[model samples]
Target: MKVDALYREQEQLAKKAVFYDAFGKLDSIAGIDCSYYGDLIIGGAVVIDLNTLEPVEKAHTILKLDFPYIPGLLAYREAKAMISACRKLKSDVDVLMIDGFGTNHPRRCGIATQIGLQLEMPTIGVGKSFLCGNIRDDGYVYQGAERTGKLIYSSRSKKPVYVSPGHRISLDTSVELVEKCMKSDRIPEPTRLAHEYVTGVKNTLK
Candidate 1:
């Protein structure tokens, strides 16, 4: 098998998408996002101080996408550029918030999970919509028989965000961490900032 093929197989083995039920401090938080311009991908990441919720460092990169876009296999299409951009960060971050699914995916591995596995760091997925699973009556618990994730209605007037553990955390812990990163919106601050940061830099694309 080719090296990339072997790594994909390795990714499959690295994922532990199930709930872990634990919590930890997030002194430094990083968010990741990507945008596309034609056949090019513009990936961005931002790291912020938890106390101030302000970006202390940021990185962005442009790359020609080699993989075709696939629904559940978004990691293969986007993770490389995202990881490259994230690596440009000079400081360490306690957690990474990604704009994709985590365990909410069919294989129990979303883009966030793949990135987390590669980075070997704590990560959380904050998706705008569910790729899989059904929300319970409480609207907080999302489950599909054995697999589960969380949906948070941060504000009554706003729709809930699909939350899942990417790696190094549990469903409950994912929620707790998101709440700490929340400002006045349903979207987590780290991911929100990352999206804005990436989109802004994407203007250079052809």
Candidate 2:
């Protein structure tokens, strides 16, 4: 994919994000994760009921890579497969959690933000490693000089994961929802289920 094209899409995505929802009531949470098998991408989407915190439905898809595995341009490489899997969900996704950065990107339009904007739904980025955000004394995350997201320190986590608003959600609310869905020390339950599903599928195919 062309850098110019991604930039163009990022520009448009930013504009759409301005119209995002930050206070929508959430009932169901959807999480997405992508794994690779050589040159192929396998994506999984899992929808979990917030009240029960158990996966209600799961979907997966495999696709040929269309873009390079660049650090910041992962949305271009992975979003299509994820969207395909997300389409299989029977329940409505009130909030989405993705295995990547949200506003914590160079362009503030990472994969989570891109897909969230595309779906016009509330989304949060749940990254295990630090991407491009700094944590403050009070735990606010800043990218460069502007505040973008926050860090969630799990009792069982060796390192904190970055949490940021992807689309149609506030940074605070993003953290709250992630904490609600978390059943592990490192990752949230919704995303953990999606990751396990994709990992199992990728291993089987390999």
lDDT: which candidate is best?
2
lDDT of 1 by residue, 1-206 (tens): 35466456645644554356334566898999999988889889999898888899999989998988656777888889889988999997888889998777766778888888888778888899867877677655455565457777665327878888888877777888787788887788899899998888887553
RMSD values for the candidates in order, in angstroms, are: 3.2, 1.8
Tens-place lDDT per residue, model 2, 1-206, is: 57888787786776667424565567899889999999899999999999999889999999999788777888889999998999878788888899998888778888888998788777889988777766789887887787787888777877777888888887878888888887765888988899999999999997
Model 2: lDDT of residue 121: 75
Supply the global lDDT for candidate 2.
0.84
- Count clashing residue pairs in model 1: 0
Poorly placed runs, candidate 2 (over 4 Å): 19-23
Candidate 1, run of 10 with poorest lDDT? 14-23
Per-model CA lDDT versus the true structure: 0.80, 0.84
TM for every model, in the order presented, reads 0.87, 0.92
Instruction: Show where candidate 1 strays beyond 4 Å.
Output: 1-11, 14-24
